[model samples]
Target: MWSANAIKSRREALSLTLTDLAQRLDVTKSYLSYIESGKRAPTPEQAVLLGK
Candidate 1:
């Protein structure tokens, strides 16, 4: 299972703002927030994109 904490940590390590990562993921900031908060999971395609 994916860890929301890990994703947030990596994004911070990369110095990416929520808006920045949201743009890269082509998702809304709220949606990304939900992902990072463990309230929601990315779709399979989104997961692939995130993996890149």
Candidate 2:
């Protein structure tokens, strides 16, 4: 499960902002925001990248 809490935690653990993570993931900040807010789910590809 790609939990929002996990995403937030991992980003924090790496000292990354949503912008930073978005840049790294080649996605928009708003898209990442939606994912984090549980308004949307990431694609399998995005999930893999985000998981890493």
Candidate 3:
């Protein structure tokens, strides 16, 4: 499983906003924000999508 920082780092490295990454992952921006902030974790399927 990826840590929250890892997700945020990857997203920022790609120059993507939370909204952009959320759209690509088929998730809500708030949810993605939560994941990045360590307030929540992505589900297994979300993790798979995030890795891509």
Candidate 4:
């Protein structure tokens, strides 16, 4: 499982805003925020996409 910190670090390292990454992942910014904040987890498919 990808940790919330890992996802957040990667996003920041890539200089992507929440909205930008949400669009790329085809998810809502609120959903992404939840994932980043450890309030939720990504689905398997979303994990694969995020891995890319």
1-52 in candidate 3: lDDT tens per residue? 8899999999999999999999988989999999999999899999999888
Model 2 scores worst on lDDT over the 10 consecutive residues at: 1-10
lDDT of 1 by residue, 1-52 (tens): 5679988988899999999999999999999999999999988888887787
Candidate 2 overall lDDT versus native:
0.89
- Please report the candidate that would top TM-score against the real structure: 4
Q: In model 4, which runs have C-alpha deviations exceeding 4 angstroms?
A: none
Candidate ranking under TM-score, highest first, comes to 4, 3, 1, 2
Model 2 CA RMSD to the hidden true structure, in angstroms: 0.9
Model 3 alpha-carbon miss at residue 8, Å: 0.3
Clashing pairs in 4: none
Which residue pairs collide, candidate 1? none
lDDT of 3: 0.94
lDDT of 4 by residue, 1-52 (tens): 8999999999999999999999988999999999999999999989999999
Cα lDDT of candidate 1 equals 0.89
TM-score of each: 0.90, 0.89, 0.91, 0.96
Tell me how far the alpha carbon of residue 17 in candidate 4 is from the true structure, in angstroms, after superposition. Answer: 0.4
Model 2 CA lDDT for position 9: 85
